[model samples]
Target: MDPREGEFVDRMGLVMERFGGTRTMGRMYAWLMVCDPPHQSLTELAARLGVSKTAVSTVARQLELTGMIERVPTASREHRYQVAAGGWEHVMKVQFAALRQAVETLDLGLAAVGGDRPEQRARLEETRDFFAWTERDADDMLRRWRDSREDLDR
Candidate 1:
């Protein structure tokens, strides 16, 4: 294995662990995202990630199901894996939409309070507003990120 690739995989594993994914899974995803070839065979992924091909295959399949990676077909019948372009954007959109549902739940809780507690209702409304702000700004934040990516590309 390349020493440089080892360093990259180690760092990627840490990032994946932070993001609630397995270390190898994170490393595999990271490699797929930025490797020079833009795609990796299962053997290559396993070698780089310091795991078995079967392990890489499992993680790759999971990421593929999540739309984070895709399979490329070649005339040789060998498969290569690549990180899906714009996948992070799609993931963020889905995550923010889920968060919005939490905000709605908070609103429902605020509504359940009886008429006698105006002060408590006000506080609850404030809490609800916080989530509301997040929901409202989620799209803008994603747009800004997309714009920044475009700027980087240019």
Candidate 2:
């Protein structure tokens, strides 16, 4: 692990808190990123993060479900976890899908509400446009990210 790992984890915790996630979620995530061997057992995570095994277990499950981390194969009954392969990219894909869904749902709303009243339609249109823009931007960024990774490989 990096010498600055604790500092980084704390910073991530603060950042994640702003995003409506528990600070432990971010700290565990940051620790996973820099931890040697990458994979960690619940006990290891708890010890390093100064949290309880139960807390680690709970947060780990949440992270796994969100596609941020994944369980590693272990012969022992105790499960170990590490950051998922392409996890950041997976996060982007999930968010992109959400943005697309939001746009679609807003479109349905626009249709149901009818277009004759500009006042009523303006807010819906603007919200739809916001999500639509986000979806388009995310699509482009994903493409660029793939291209950049390809270039790195080359």
Candidate 3:
């Protein structure tokens, strides 16, 4: 690993943890992102991140479920993992779906409060509108991301 890689790993660890994942998950993800050969066995990951293989395995399973990473096929029986294509896109989709759901739930709150309660209804209405707008904005951003992604590889 490069000397600067540790800083990046630490940064990503904090970032992933902020996103409600373990620091280990972020660190492993970070390592995978910058690692040469682009995929690694569980043992390599654990040793590089200074964590247990069990911890790496657990996070790898969770990350796979989230579509952030994938288990790569190897000639040997050992499993190798790497960052998945469209991972950021997958994360945004999940988050945007939650935002859409939030808007729906907020609308229900608005209905339960009724139009007669202006002050109570106002808060829910504002929140609902904001969430609806966020979903719309996210959709637009995702479109733009798709359009420009090819350039990103360059």
Instruction: Give the better candidate number (1 or 3) by lDDT.
Output: 3
- Candidate 2 or 3, higher lDDT? 3
Maximum-lDDT candidate: 3
Residue runs of model 3 more than 4 Å from their true location after superposition = 151-154
Compute the lDDT of residue 107 as modeled in candidate 1: 80
Local accuracy of candidate 1 as per-residue lDDT tens digits, 42-144: 9888877779998988998878877788999877766799989877777678778877787888788787886688998888888888878988999999889
| lDDT against the true structure, each candidate | 0.83, 0.91, 0.92
The worst-scoring run of ten residues by lDDT in candidate 3 lies at: 145-154
Taking the tens digit of each residue's C-alpha lDDT, what string does model 2 give over 1-154? 4558889999999987987789999999999999998999999999999999999999999999989999999999999999987777887798789887899899998998896878879999999999998887997898999999999999
Tell me the alpha-carbon RMSD of every candidate. Answer: 2.6, 2.1, 1.6
The alpha-carbon lDDT assigned to residue 139 of candidate 1 equals 91
Per-residue lDDT value at 103 in model 2: 90
After superposition, the stretches of candidate 1 with alpha carbons farther than 4 Å from their true spots are: 34-36, 115-127, 152-154
